[model samples]
Structure formats: C-alpha cells, structure tokens
Target: MSIVDGNPNVDTTVFYNASNENNLLYPDKFHQWQTRNNFKSYRQIGRFSDNEIAEHLPVDKDKTVVLIGGPDKMGSHWIKALKQMGIERSQIYYEKFSW
Candidate 1:
C-alpha cells in the first residue's frame, strides 16, 4: 500500500497504490482523470491546525471544504472547530474510512 500525496504540503489522498497492490481503485474504474488522475496545483494543508485551516480557507462562501480521514476522533474535532470558525455544515463534507 502507498499513499499518493496529492500535494507535498498536505498529506491528503491517502489512497492505496492499486498498481503496487495489483488491485483496482473502485472510483478509478468508473471515473478516471484525463491527465494525472489527481489534483494539481493546490496548496497542501499538511495537517495544519483547525485555526490555520480556517485562516487559509477561501473567502468565497460557496467554496466547499472536504475533510477525509480514517474513523478517528480528530475528524470530529476538526468539524467542531471549523463550525466555530463560522464554516457552515452545508459547506463541509466529511468522509471517514472504516479500514
């Protein structure tokens, strides 16, 4: 297994390396990127604090914030902190992995 760091700054996209594991990623089977199959040119959060995340969040209220991680308590804390920073529930998406 390998974690494909989408951005050097943030350790997001903790996906398994299908090629290395000889298995196919479920989403990639149906929807595939035309180019790099990953995001490009976005700054990394690098596991920054909730305050830092709030500070760096774009001013555009329409922007969506996605927080993904394993089923950990830290994710809940992050949500709470973001809410305290005035981030709306509609603007945040939290995805937790069981495995």
Candidate 2:
C-alpha cells in the first residue's frame, strides 16, 4: 500500500496551521507500516503539483484509490487523470473538503 500525503507543511493538524501534520502523524508511523506490503508514504510539502500526482500514482488494475482532503476542483482533476490512466470509476473514491 502507498500513501500520498500533501500538507502546507510537515505538521498534521485538524485545524489549519503551519505544522498541523505533526498532530496526526506519530513518530515512525510510516516506517512501522512499511513492514507489510511495502507500505510507503509520499509527503508533498507545500504545493502539490500535477507532476507530483502523475509521478506518485501509477496505473494498476487491482488498485483501490481513495482521493480525500483537497479542493473540490483539484479532486475532479485528479479523477480525470486517474481515468486517463485506465483506472475505473468504480475503483476510485473521493472525499472532498466541504469548505
């Protein structure tokens, strides 16, 4: 399993903050998870470019992808990209930020 995490900074927070990610991620969480199925986490500090999205996400028929916590428009763009990669719509899930 692979995770692509994007935040304004290194911290994880429920609320908006410079270092919010620290609030959500425990120390060595990524490393610990990597023991099974080669769990990997890709952290995108600051802006998440389309290039990064294209790079991290690979085309896989058996992949289950969930797109969460981003702008609604960006989510749509991501869905489109996934479609172009031959990812089926039923295999994609998205939870867009309400705000």
C-alpha TM-score for every candidate:
0.45, 0.53
What tens digits encode model 2's per-residue C-alpha lDDT throughout 18-83? Answer: 225554344465555444453445553354555765565554556545445567986797778767
lDDT of 1 by residue, 6-98 (tens): 343432332222223333344452233213444322223234556656665556646545554545575687777777777787766666766
Clashes of 1: 1
Cα deviation of 2, candidate 1, in Å:
15
Local error of candidate 2 at residue 8 (angstroms)? 27
TM-score of 1: 0.45
User: Per model, how many backbone clashes are there?
Assistant: 1, 8
Each candidate's root-mean-square deviation in Å?
Answer: 9.3, 8.5
In order, the Cα lDDT scores of the candidates are: 0.49, 0.52
Model 2 regions more than 4 Å off: 1-28, 35-37
TM-score between model 2 and native = 0.53
Error of 1 at 17 (Å): 18
- What value does the lDDT take at residue 97 in candidate 1? 64
Candidate 2 global Cα RMSD: 8.5
